[model samples]
Target chain A: MDIDNISELIPQPVPLRDIDDSPGPCCMSFGFDLNPLIQSIEKVGLINPPLLKRDNQGSITIIIGYRRIKALKSLKADGAGCRILSGDDILPVECLLLNLYDNLAVRKLNDVEKGMVLARLIPWIKTLEIVEHYMPFLGLPSNRATLSSYLKIEEEMEVRVRESIACGQLSLRNAIMLLDIDSISRSSIIDLISNLKLTVNQQRQLIEYTVDLSHIQGRPIPDFLDDQSIKEINSDTRMNNPQKGRALIRYLRMKRYPSVSKAERKFKKMISRLNLGKTVKIDHSPSFESPYYRLEVLFKDGQSLREKLENFMREDIDSLRDPWKKKK
Target chain B: MDEGVQKYKSTKSILLQLKDIPVRAEKDDGPEEVACVSNELKRDMGKDTMHLVSYQGEFLKPCPGTKEYICCGYQILNVGTNCPLDCSYCILQTYFNRPNLRVHVNLEEQLGQVFQTIDSDPDKIFRVGTGEFTDSLALDPIIRWSETILRGFSERKNTVLELKTKTANTAGLLGSKYRDRIIVSWSLNSPFISCREEHGAVSLTRRLECARECQSEGFTIGFHFDPIIQHSNWMDEYRKTVDLMDKYIEPEGIIWMSLGSFRFMPALKPIIRRRHPETSILDGEFVLGLDGKMRYFKPIRMELYAFLNELLHQWHPDLGLYLCMESNEVWQESMGWRPETSEGLGNYLDERVRNFFG
Candidate 1:
């Protein structure tokens, strides 16, 4: 804990191969590109030496600067200067805290990296302690639900999905929905989402509709996604990606709610048959949940409004009954 | 000793009797534990557990009704919170933060306060019920709530106590001599829904048989066709229930029957999905209503109500049919008339009370 030393601890030139470079228990870096660090080291020869901890077996582990070592190795550098500490001198938790603080001071961690930090802390600290002290330090809301979500993400999600989330391709909310299903179905849905390049709203609808359909139809989500109509929408050449995404959602929604869709179609047909002028319009509430229909006339003045109302009164408005109702 | 146990003389006997019943040590696959989101709360909702607490709130409170719809103006006698039954569509899944079968052991001591409130308004008819927060008779065998509070309400002229339940455990009520102003109501649903959705509930036949037994004993009865769902051949399914009612129950003895469609707050949707994964109750087309709960579309609701109205009216036109938490438009369209407001609906039900008990 003595930081104001006259001269720092001795820095030694350690062979890169001697150190275990894989993300150790202390590492919180994930879904990162090493090329930028490699290019930086290539230009400015490693200014701050990485931290290493040597065990009793004389094996070295990188306590900090995991990305630096990975970058150095990628650049074919055989050795780098690193400060060493005996593993007995510092506890594993202290080492983790050192790495965490070191990373926090420089750059913000991605969602996956934050999960990694919380996961690493779980073994050494109580949940409440973590929620109170460390969660705020990691810039997360101090709640058990959020903590459970992060733990599940780190412990359950595959590398590809985590990578997608870390790189800003998929949202954390949508990824949580994927966790409720099996891995095969999750992968298929993830692939479709990526290929279609769905927006956040579209991604949510896609997952919700797919899950509801699977439960209703008593089939796996992958099987439902493999339907011929869905594939046709995906492979349609004339439609763009956004159009296909919309068409896919429309197809699934129609399948999920057949009665509502039929009623909507009938209502639209009936309204078109009325053919009131372009200035006058009739609109039903969302899903036709309300009993009353709205009438709007875009008139320029009182005389124009009166004329439109007279025209509306002349139409057979009583035909505008509940679409599902039969004619008397 | 807690005040709840010290004040109520029967709490000691109830606790002694509860010790004889074997409770599951671990949580079961029940709806109460499944609906819990937090681990702390889940642990609190122990399997088949009971808690004796002196309820601190008012013993009698008005039913919390929204102004967006017609309300029956029923008074809720807070006998307890939570229930022994685990019906899939229960709103109590998320209604309370605390969990367990909480029996207000001080209910007997607080009856005078409740009566005072009712007696203060001499002209107002208190259509009181105990089944709003919990089932009326599900735990009656052990708790003996009927023995404590039945006579008090039965002796009152301006008040009627209705014990609504899905269980056929009416032994305590039948053993009692208080039947003048007491209405034993059964929540009736279609047989398909009864078997599939109403977990731990008595069968439709058994319930109807109980009603017949109660009516034969000179007790006026009521029925609620609430949450009338739309399913495959729903008309036929409900008609089957009606036919069974025709067999076991007399139409003349029934006082009032309520018809309501399936509606719930949005928060209960996920809880229902999590608890009842294989349930088909969520397959209907629902839209947000004016009161912020998800309900079936207007036309669908009209279809359900109109169909049941015709069937019930055919059974007995004087069965005093009414709709729960519905709009004036729905009442007019479905039942051929409208109560127009909550007060109007309350007056109608109060009239029913007077006609039955006066």
Candidate 2:
């Protein structure tokens, strides 16, 4: 965009203009703020005169300076004069392009956003396309494979990430990595993340362990739920230790489709069988709140609850039908 | 004397040529007065912080492959190596060849390397950090290097940039439009170190105060306790640090908090002895690990972990705390948990960062 004489440009203000909310084909993101522009206007007194277009019905439309316009409105509301420079100068296509360029250039756009922007830009001009266009415009190479990878959505992994966010368990970085990982390792990864609520380093260790598992197993990483090995281990391995039992129970609970609704029911049944609690109390959150379900069992002060649980859950024990078992 | 050499009189300015020249005092010994300045003078000098020299070089490079099995899988950004501050136990003394700090002012060159690597593999989420080789934001205000780096990576989804430092110098990143794209992190330690070994560094309160400000500005903040020092009343000291963190900083705003016992290379001991003779960092009970770095024994490390873990859980159960360069067995003994692999840490951390800020 070429700049003309600063004196020749005339500024015009549209009073109480009725503009369409769903205006078609505008390059501005809805949440753009005008404070920076207001500061700019305060300093230089509106350097790039606001651009305006007129419709056949004589309605004035703002082609650029959305931020400038909003700042004026706020100024008017505060009982200050909405002092704007009226302009009659016609803005060239390059000028409109400059507005978009300035906005996109300074603000760093993420890979996905860049891809979406580039994909949208493809239709604007057909002849000058691909990486050459982006290279000149945004300093990004428009390689198709690179573009595709940014746009790729591993839905299962995304869901797990969302679940982590929901449960307050995982982070966005870890979630994204888990999504990109081989599907075979996703289950064990998900189990580790959700169960122990490991830190970033621990989670990384887990992924490294899974990668090693893949290398050693001679098979692709297994889906934690669908993997035959994990299932077999779950079924046959006795929860001999309390910690191990708790982990297994957690695995089972997570596996229960749509989540095990009556988590308290299992606790109640176990309590009755083992004479576990003197009194049992349960707390549930308000629908919108957290800890959707919680079960707390109060045992007698002198009771050896830790030992009792450990004895019942030993991996060597064969059957839970009989709590008493000894080696031959 | 040449004008360039005359202009660079102080050890501070001389150190700026670290990457290029071996820094030596004019008196043949060292800059005794520069070394003797009270911590207060250092802070004053920070305001009119001198930019001695700038270099044109690649910023982010892939980690050099090590023959040793255990390596921190981190990519280095040669932004600014070594710090101007006189921290007695600073790893920069041994990490770099000379004490003079260097800031790669050739941002375009740095960006060229970074964008090249990131563009090459869009599918792979690379964990690249500037703090690995330099204080990521130490020269932030004067150079605005981190701002430039942040701007460069802001558009890429596959890369997460971590600007780790002990300085609260964040004027360069006050109002980042791409706040989600970068993580502003701090290296945390007990208040004792804030007064002792960490000379010229901001106080713990000031550091957390800055973190609080960053969190308010919608930046994902991180805390690192790499080299969690062993000392008398270590648990109490660490717990106090965590409690203070909980008080000043919001847990959700934190992306990750790493725990690492203080480990040192055998070669670094002499450097500390010669340079910072008064430092007590090498005084603690430590043994050589498989990696051959002197470390606190397994039991001491475990005790520190267990106490810190409980305190962190009590403070914020959701806070992401992971150990740095620790074994799976250590993890199990301390936290009663074993991560299956290295990716477990990366994946969990990635998930936590994304989920927390996605």
Candidate 3:
């Protein structure tokens, strides 16, 4: 059906209570804010009447303008003008396409909304069709992996996690990581993420460390996160949220990689004993994967360089070895 | 002997064998079906199915080795892709886009061309193996790959065909009269890893027993400790496997034994986690190497390789111990000597081949 001809339909008054305001089959909106839409309807009366389909039993379902109807309902309007289509006149897929195209023309759908659209399209069209045409049309990467991630978002994620993703508080990549755990663990992790206000990178590190530690320690994620040290870090008054996040990640990393952490601590202790001055420093490769260590010296002139080198060479220069190596 | 003969006759040809197996033959239409399906569905559907297609790619190619590490210049014999054994740490999980136990049905017809390539370079010892892409003997019971290609390789002088496997399906090898220039190798790991991670594989004791049987039948065997994982009491656990080797057979008949720590591409982490959630293989402290693969920390890898090298050398001094794809520092520190470069490692293995077979 040509959706352009729908404008020719006459408007009728439908009682707000009679229409099902819940998200219908064609609705792709989720974790959306109604304030802007509500303000718009308050400033100017409903500019375009919401499209609704009435069944033979007189039950009404909103096809478009779900947000508009929701705003009107909040405004306590008893009835509003709506463009009604007989349920038999239009197909469900056609209604979905109409809403999709209408929404695409006016605004961009958030990640959760895109997931909702894909979830709805999955029942109507083939996955190949959605991947080739609808995914790109919805501004998502046209790949099965990306499609699978979005489907999980819509189908498996809890509402609070979806809200976190939609509001840009949590990243979609991090949210996908939470899907591997149970709902309770996911909720607790989401709570920690929100409370700490972690950056995307920190969120990823937290989830990775938590998951790896859980697997290694043979404990669930909630049980792992409920350790006394973690709780102490979270409740520490001296540290801010970002500090708490970093401290929690450090704690988990130490637990996950005990040998690496111990080696790092040993190196730190040895370096402190050497008393390398402000201008002189020593460093090792990340994780000590490289067999060599670096000695850096900063000087103002050639004479200063020589003096600093001579000074650095005097006190236990031969003691520097692989941190994991025992003294012979 | 009659039942063995009948079983061989039933699966002698690919077309004849298809009658016995439960398979759905789909028409070749397009790439849409394979490309668009979810990985979970693809894995479930492809696990038990076999697709017989005439492979059009090069039948013989060099192992794709990175320059950052010393690779033992082995060549890959493209007999098939994918494996029946679903080890949790298998790199084949994310390596292939299409799924199935794809056996190159035209391998018999293409043997002459592969031999021609090796014959063209007579001076270059082609250390070819069929276990790189798929297990060399996992499907040998039905596909009869051994019956078709064993005689050709047995006749060649400059090459050795290594049929590597984790299975005890050596009936085909023993059934064939040809034994020269064929190395029957088994991928050995700790019994804990074998039982927990390697799904559908035989037990460690069974594998060692098969190795002993092959040795008694005048077949020189090999063992690989590639992907030695770090778990609880890993040192003691791995010792159990080496001790089992001591009980089964003499180390004097063994050829090369390789030691390699677990490494994988970054993309495979999620796949492993999803496919095998209870796996302890990913619990090590991993760092990105120059080759862009995540490997155990340098110290951890050295520890593992060093322990195994000492243990295996103690079993037999001439077991031809080597590290597969390790740097010069790692070689010197772990194995107590350095191959220094890929060519150097290749020459070392070639020398071992000459000493054993010549």
Candidate 4:
């Protein structure tokens, strides 16, 4: 086929010929929509009309744009004149390829359709089949496994992605990440995503919250959690071996060395020195990058912040007023 | 009838006097009788306007295992409760302590606080909807709360308003200047469920007609099939609902639609058990969700989602459709897709609204 003079090569419609609608191997999938093509037709006046081919028996058949043909039927019903130019009016190979390329590019399959496509495409159908079926293998050849992974991503997401999509909170990226998370943590993943209004990194942190793997970007998970006690432990550990990144999940869970009093001393020292917010953020330190404790305080203004600090000092003084007897 | 029952029944104020009104039909009743009771109840109750007690602002803490707050999404204006239309599975029966159909009569102050919050974040888009804890438009005829919200939000670009209800009260909404900013959302159910589960509610066609009118008036419409119950012919019923929606409302005009399967707390089970003993909602197979709410099992949910999703995609291909609060695997299995990233969904939706209206 001549790449530029492709229009002359494509077979045009033989107006009086009968077309078969049987499920042929060459038949396009019905799951796709034709409205975009119809829209294109109404917009640019069918810039490249659908390519038609004549069977050995002299009947004209559509190699593609089954949806477009159907839409034209509907448009014709609404008094829009429909016509199929002669076989000589076939679209250029380059334009035809571009049209199909744009059509598939523009088309977005729903979750189920995506799943169905994935279930059929990546797992079963071979790459040669796609190449042979569509015949435009010029740019970014997509293999079955690659498409399958895309499908697998969809297959794996949290229920909230669907629910959020239904409720309008989730996006395609959000859905894929939700799928990457474990099923048990899916709801939590969605909740964290929507409620916290978390960033992508934070969302990933929440998804990794349950998983033991908390380290990301060479930073300890405790650093991500912003726990003060964990940071103190990290600093102590760093002095001994500068590059050794500690896993906070292990420290919090294992309770190695440092007795309860020692840990409490460390905690109090950190809390007193640092500004602990009204509500303390206590993370399980499930990974090296997470926190043992984080604090966030809300103050309307600088004055409010001063007042809150004063109120805290007054409470501290009030606690000091109570005399306690030393007992053994 | 006994004197007490008669006193509570005949005296419109007494019947309407519940702090948390429980409305489950003892038997199927006529719409006229319901209308008559609601009319008398409104008259005896006298005033029907928003009486916002207070803008209860509290730090909504997160729940266990989930970083998200199990929020009512938007703030609760607490306008009224116990809809005149008796929906069989009305959440109000157990959700509210008092359902005496109370409307917070103080609109100006409530609007003032709302404006304060909205003005607080000029750069941030604050979505404040009225139907979070109650039906926003059930008392629309008398209260006209949506009009007030529409009028208030018309000038504030930072805030988007949603008036969600099961009622087809669009008369108050028509010709509003804030039609673009205010999304007129409706809770839709299958005709079968509407007839059996919902009483005194307008017919499905009527609701769709109202939606069509709103859409034509340049208002973006939203449909919600929340508490999508499991029934033998639910697939056909939902398919019909989607079909009617496609026929009536313009596809591009739909801002969003939500699908939530029937879920209930353990506390609500007894209410349904006592009130709607014959309701088939509880009869279906169920399992406790991670949230501890009773929900239909995985397979049932998958079936429901698959059927409804296919119908919706076929009908309104571009319409924004999402499932409410479901897990990732279920989202993947039923819808065959998931969010690529969790952070962008809200922004994506906000952008959709901006593109449509802004």
lDDT assessment of candidate 3: 0.87
Give the Cα lDDT of each candidate. Answer: 0.86, 0.57, 0.87, 0.54
Query: In model 3, what lDDT does residue A40 have?
Result: 89
Q: Report the C-alpha lDDT of model 4 over A108-154, residue by residue, as the tens digit.
A: 43443343333343333454564345322323234433343345544
Interface RMSD of 3: 2.8
- Give the clashing residue pairs of candidate 3, or none: none
Per residue, candidate 4 scores C-alpha lDDT tens digits across B1-358 of 1122222212233235443644332221212121123323422222232222222332111111332212223334444445555666776666333324544444534566667766887876555567755677777765566555677676788767778878787787884566657788888988789888876678888889998998888888888889898776888888888888877988888888877888877567545644554566665545556666767655567678878888889886767777776765556767777643333444656666677767
DockQ (Cα-based) per candidate?
Answer: 0.38, 0.01, 0.43, 0.01
* Pick by TM-score: 2 or 4, better one: 2
TM-scores of chain B alone in all candidate structures, in the order given: 0.93, 0.81, 0.94, 0.79
Cα distance off (Å), candidate 1, residue A22: 3.8
Q: TM-score, each model? A: 0.90, 0.45, 0.93, 0.44
lDDT, residue B140, candidate 3: 91
lDDT of 2 at A5: 46
Model number with the top TM-score: 3
Going through the candidates in order, what is the number of backbone clashes in each?
0, 62, 0, 63
Please identify which of the two predictions, 3 or 4, would achieve the higher TM-score against the true structure: 3
iRMS per model in Å: 4.1, 22.2, 2.8, 23.6
lDDT tens per residue, model 1, B151-199: 9899888899999999999999999999998999999999888899998
Q: How do the residues A182-243 of candidate 3 rate in per-residue lDDT, one tens digit apiece?
A: 89988888888999998899899888888888888899889988999989999999999989
Q: State which candidate has the highest lDDT.
A: 3
lDDT of 1 at A238: 100
